[model samples]
Target: MNGPALFYDKAAFRKAGLQPPATWKELRQAAAKPTGGRSYGLALSAVATEEGSWQYVPFLGSGGDLEQLDSAESVSALTYWTSLLHDGSA
Candidate 1:
């Protein structure tokens, strides 16, 4: 059987003219906005499975360093992720 929709609020989103963010920076900014405590900026599947790997692909791809995960670009990407977590966006 097919799984439930991974995303919620499709109808509301349609009304709001919402579109998927084109860049990580845009996503981060959106998530950081205050929405009267009724909205979340971001959420990712951290479950120990393929979903986790999928969630991480953006950072890895942006960094362009698979062999050296600790490269400067990687660190920057990780820092961005940490900021989302700290800001309660992720």
Candidate 2:
């Protein structure tokens, strides 16, 4: 119900010479910053139902089609989702 906002550790980003990611791809890239051996770039919840689907909307909007789940768009969306989880970027 609220709008999107970036809640980052500003000091850390500043020390690392980084900025808030402006897009999904930027987010993916930003999520790769080295934590000097102990932290992740991002975190997310993983529950079933509306919350889970809500988390997917961005990717779906980035490249997906509800009417044709098998289309390249949908596949790209799904792939991004899987990669995020697999790579621990979300």
Query: Which of the numbered candidates is closest to the native, going by highest lDDT?
Result: 2
Model 2 earns a TM-score of: 0.74
CA lDDT scores, all candidates in order: 0.65, 0.72
Question: How close to the true structure is residue 46 of candidate 2, measured as C-alpha lDDT?
Answer: 62
Clashing pairs in 1: 31-41
Clashes (N, CA, C under 3 Å) per candidate: 1, 0
Candidate 2 RMSD to the real structure: 2.5
- Model 2 weakest lDDT span, ten residues long: 34-43
lDDT of 2 by residue, 1-90 (tens): 523445788887787788888887877787777333457777655678776566666567766876788999999988877787678665
Deviation of model 2 at 59, angstroms: 1.2
Candidate 1 lDDT at 45 equals 68
State candidate 1's TM-score: 0.66
Candidate 1's displacement at residue 12, Å, is 5.4
Off by over 4 Å in 2: 1-6, 34-38
